[model samples]
Target: MSLFSAAVAGFGTGLSLIAAIGAQNAFVLRQGIQRRHVGAVVAVCVLSDAALILAGTAGMGALVETAPWALTAARIGGAVFLAAYAALALRRSLRPAALTVDASAAGPGGRSAGRGPLAAAVLTCLALTWLNPHVYLDTVVLLGSVAATHGDGGRWRFAAGAVAASVVWFVAIGYGARVLRGLFARPVAWRVLDAVVAAVMLALAASLVAGIPG
Candidate 1:
């Protein structure tokens, strides 16, 4: 196939995998709506995915196969991280003042926090990306294996396309969420959203624990 075709294939495949409503997307959506360090959050997510896609394209998938323990470690760490985060989200819902702050917070370009808040946001984003085993499965393994079908030159192009998709999708989710500003202007809405985030995070942790089963 031509480079263009390979790229299109990669874009579509990546979209299909990431478009699903998972922990990463949920966190992105929440950050987007909260308008707290959105640029940083989006950049972290996009860059992380790009790195993973490139690693997969570069044949890191084989290394992953030889190091199955890596994923197991990620799974355990991710679950703990996600569960703790879920509890935080749930706790936030109980604090009316927290949602009030979210409702009147800055725009997509606003600072969600400073010093401590920034550090927490960045740390959470990193944990959400690196701790998640599914990310390794889908990007490093599945996407990498799929890229091989396009041959050498085409595979790189495919990886590029996938990376592009990550950039586009994250930008859209992070910035596009601003359109719902009116809806999220209410503190109740923020609370509801937090509850949903908690549920999603817990669900993701549960799925990780279940895995493929014996």
Candidate 2:
């Protein structure tokens, strides 16, 4: 296939994988709606994905497949984090009055009132991105192997396309969430969002614990 065809294939694949409703996307949506460190959060996600995509394109996916222990460790850690985050979401859902688009609603940490909201957002975004084992499966193992199908030059084009998809998807969600601020201004809206977040997080955690590929 030509380089352009390879790029298009990679772009489509990357978008499909990243567009899934998971912990990372959910967190980004929340941050976007709240208008809390939106740029930072999006940056962390896109950059992390780029790094992983590069690694996968470089053939690190094969190495990852050889190490069952690494995936097991990631699954355990991701499950724990997701579960804890779900609890937080559940708590927020129960307290509708506390739910607001204002940054002061939860403070910078997102859990409680403290300093360094940027730091908290960055850390949470990183965890949600890196801790998930599926990320490795998609960006590293899957995307890498697929890229290899193209010729040597075509593979680099494919990787570029994949990286571009990540950039586009993240920027759109992170920035586009602002359009929903009017709706989210209502406390009930926050309750619903948090409830949904809770469900998604718990489901993902359960899947991870169950050793599911998705």
Candidate 3:
């Protein structure tokens, strides 16, 4: 296949993989709604996926595929991280907020009080992306398999296309949701969203612990 064709194929695969509602997407959407450090969140997600795609193109996917220990470690770490994140989300959902007597005084409170620290948001994104074995299978193994069909030069083009898709999608989801930021500003809305996020994290953690394939 030509490099252009390989890149187009990779882009399609990336969109198909990332369009699903998974742990990572849920986290990003939640952070976006809460008006957190959205740029940092998008950057971490895109860069992490790019790294994995490059690794897969470079043949690192084969090494990971052969390493059961690596997969096991990732599963355990992901479970722990998701569980902790669920707890944090639940806590945020339940926390009391200072009530404002004047309607004008009310603004984005709750999780939207202030943008989270950039470094912390980036670390959180990294943990969510890297700790999950599913990420490897999706970005590395599956995508790599597709790239491999195109031969050496085409593989790099494929990886670049995949990386581009990730960057575009994350930026859209992370910032585009700002259009509805007002709707999510309500405490009840925040609680509902956080609860949903907590459920997703817990479910993902349970699935990992059960050795269910991503």
Candidate 4:
């Protein structure tokens, strides 16, 4: 196949994996709506995906696919993290604080006017990216395998296409979600959103547990 065709195929494949409503997308939406270091978060996501895609393109995906134990460990760690975040969301739902709600509010943890909050936000972004086993499974193994079908030069183009998809997705979710800022402006709406987040997190955790090594 031609490089252009391969790139298009890769782009479509990447979107098929990421466009779904999953943990990573949810966190990015929340951060975007909260208007907290959105650019940095988006950058982290795009760059992380790029690295993972490149690794896959370079054939790391095959090596990873051969190791089920590593994915099992990641599943356990990710489930624990998601459960903790779910509890936090539950707490937020039950005890609705006086949210700033305006265009300008503190971080989700409610800290402002310091580097601490920004640093914390960055850490959360990294955790969300690295801890999830699905990211590796989809981007690294699955996408990498797909790219290999395109041959060497075609595979690189395919990887570029996949990276482009990541850029588009993160930019859109990290910025487009701001459109819902007014809807989430009320404490009631915030509570509802947190409840939804909690549910999603729990569901993801359950799935992770189900996938654990028996």
Candidate 5:
């Protein structure tokens, strides 16, 4: 296949894998709506995806496949982290009035009074990306296998396309979420969003647990 075709295929596959409302996307959306450290959040996501894709292209997928224990460890860790995040979201949902007041007091970027510190947010982003076993399955195994089918030269093109898709998707969702700022201006909206986030996090946690071997 031609390099362009390989790239397009990779881009499409990458977008399809990540376009879902997973933990990472939910966190990005929340940060975006809060008008918080969106750049940092998006940067972490994009760079992480790029690194994973490159690793996959370099055939790290085989190593991951051989290590069943690694995935199990990641599954448990991811589930715990996600469950804790869900509890936090649920707690925040219970206090929409406080969120509203704090959000109103929030200053632009850097360190907003209402938003978590940049370091904390970045840490959470890293956890959501790295700890999830599914990330390994999807980016490393699946994408890598597909890229390999395109032959050595085309595989690099495919990987590049996948990385491009990550960049585009994160940037769009991270910034585009601000369009909902007007709606989230209401306390009820904040409550609803937190509630939804909690649900997504919990569901993802459950799914990860279910994937573990008996």
Candidate 6:
């Protein structure tokens, strides 16, 4: 296939994989709604995906395809990360909404106050992108498998297209969702949002642990 064809194929594949309601997407949406380091969150998500897509294109994905041990380790690490993230989300959900603060007071004295929003966002993005076996299966194994059909030169083109799609989708989701922050200003809305995030995270973690195929 030509480079154009490869790019189109890669774009479609990337969209299909990322359109799902995964933990990473959930975290991005939640952070956007909470108006907490949204730019940082979006950047991490897009950049991480781009990096992975690049690796997959570079034929690094074949290494993962050859290693069962790598897959197993990824599964274990992903499960732990998801479980911990779920617990944190649940705690935040259960906390009284009155404790939430405006973005201005979102510092140390703020409700969800922490010194590591950027770090946390990066770590979370990494866990969701790298540790998760599904990410590898979809972006690396599956995408790489398909790209291989287009010949060696086409693979890089495909990967580039996929990375581009990730950048567009993640940036839109992370920043665009911020427009709804006002609607969630009420404490009840905050609680409801957190509750939904908690449920999504927990359910995703359980599904991952259950070895559900992506």
- TM for candidate 6 is 0.86
lDDT of 3 at 129: 89
Query: What's each prediction's TM-score?
Result: 0.91, 0.93, 0.88, 0.93, 0.94, 0.86
Candidate lDDT (C-alpha), each: 0.85, 0.90, 0.80, 0.88, 0.90, 0.75
Lowest-sum lDDT 10-residue window in model 5: 101-110
User: Which pairs, if any, clash in model 4?
Assistant: none
- The local lDDT score (0 to 100) that residue 31 gets in candidate 5 is 85
Higher-lDDT candidate among 1 and 5?
5
Evaluated at residue 214, the lDDT of candidate 3 is 45
lDDT by residue (35-127, candidate 5, tens digit) is: 678999999999999999999999999899999999999999999999999999999889754455244474334334456678998999999
- Residue 78 displacement in candidate 1 (angstroms): 0.6
Model 5: CA > 4 A from native: 101-112
**How well is each residue in 1-214 modelled by candidate 2, as lDDT tens digits?**
9889999999999999999999999999988887778889999998999999989999999999999889999999999999999999999889775677866556433564322368888999999999999999999999999999997899889999999999999999999998998998898998989999999999999999999444
What CA RMSD would you report for each candidate? Answer: 3.5, 2.9, 3.8, 2.2, 2.8, 2.9
RMSD of 6: 2.9
Candidate 1 clashing pairs, residues 3+ apart or interchain: none
Residue-level lDDT for 175 in candidate 3: 80
Model 1 weakest 10-residue run by lDDT: 107-116
Better structure of 5 and 6 per lDDT: 5
Q: Which stretches of candidate 3 lie over 4 Å from their true place?
A: 96-112, 212-214
Candidate 2, run of 10 with poorest lDDT: 107-116
**What does candidate 4's lDDT look like per residue over 18-136, in tens digits?**
89887788889888887778899999999999999999999999999899999999999999999998898888787755343554445456754223367887898898789999999
**lDDT per residue, candidate 6, 1-214, as tens digits?**
6899899888888888987888888878767665678788788788878877777777878998888777877777787887788777767666663335355545334434433467867777767777788888888778777777778888888887788889888887887877876776666776777677777767766766777334
Cα lDDT of model 1 by residue, 1-214, tens digit: 8999999999999988878887788878877876778899999999999999999999998789888778787888888999999999999777756564353444334533322376777788988988999998999999999999999899999998899899889999998988877897787887898899899999999888887334
* Candidate 3 lDDT score relative to the true structure: 0.80
The per-residue C-alpha lDDT of model 5 at residue 50 equals 95
